[model samples]
Target: MEERDKQLLKMIRKQSEEGMSLLIDEYGGAIKAICSNVLRNYDAGIVQDAMQETVIRLWQKLSQRFQVKKNLRAYIYQTARNCALDYLRKYQRHSETDFEGVEDMMQDVSTDVEREFSRKHNERIVHEVIKEMEEPDRTIFILRFFYYETVKVIAETVHLKEDNVESRIRRGKKKLKAELLRRGVLNE
Candidate 1:
């Protein structure tokens, strides 16, 4: 935490809306970038919702629990990742297409473009796998790996009970690794 961040957090701790606004102005882009990356599809409405959720969570808890010694960027990233993941888990369930055609589509993209295409294709597969996960597991994985959120904060953001976040993280990693292997991203 920089001296400036410490000062800003102090102001925010006072529940000054202006301080919260300043925090958003300074950190919103980074948070949005992480959300967009994790969601793999961007909508202004979804982004705004995630941003609002993150800021509200921070405003509610920053004074009571935040430590000036912690990195604010990491905190913000964790919050944004959780917010986006929860939103996706809730809303994407009814919207996702089955995986039946995705592999076939990837196979036709041509050898010259295959490597570049494979990278994106893998991302799509990962996104699809995430969509299949249950509430807290899905949320936990997106924060842990996609946004590189720390375990402790991930726990706080998702409102899990005890080590539920960590346990979900473990299971989510195994599932993702299996999915990648099944997709041939990891060679047998």
Candidate 2:
């Protein structure tokens, strides 16, 4: 939370429209990126829906909890991630049967390229593992790894009070690592 962020919070708390606009303008790209990553496998409509939900959540929560010492982009990233995750969970429940053959289908792909091909293939496996993650976790991993958002900002974005964000990130990392290991993409 820099002085500028504190000022923004004050303005937002006062319900200043300009403050809201500034917040959106500054943080929108990061939010969209996280949402896009989390909902990568879903339709574009769902991804857009998730992004809107995340922005709405940020608007609703910002005035009450935003801190000047936090990173705004990270907060937006986490929020986007959580919203994406929630959407995915509901989606999975509704389409569990449709996803039944996913594992078997993944196992059947065979390519003759080794070395560079194997590396690219492993990268694809990593992407698939990320796609399989439940919403917020998938979102969080992308924000933390792909975008390099700070934990403090991530906590604020997700409305988790910092410590929770750290814990969630740790767990998310472990889960991703395990998934990669299971795919034989990571060495023990």
Candidate with the greatest lDDT versus the true structure: 1
**Candidate 2 ranges with C-alpha deviation above 4 Å:** 65-69, 97-145, 148-188
Which pairs of residues clash in candidate 2, taking residues 3 or more apart in a chain or in different chains? 1-68, 1-69, 1-70, 75-153, 75-157, 85-135, 85-136
Q: What's the CA error at residue 65 for candidate 2, in Å?
A: 4.6
- Candidate 1 on 1-188: residue-level lDDT in tens? 66767777888988777788788777776686777776666577887787788788877778785663467767777788888888888668745665667777777658748677888888888899899998988878876776666787678767776478877877888888898899787877
TM-score of each: 0.51, 0.53
130 Cα displacement, candidate 2 (Å): 15
- Model 1 ranges off by over 4 Å: 96-188
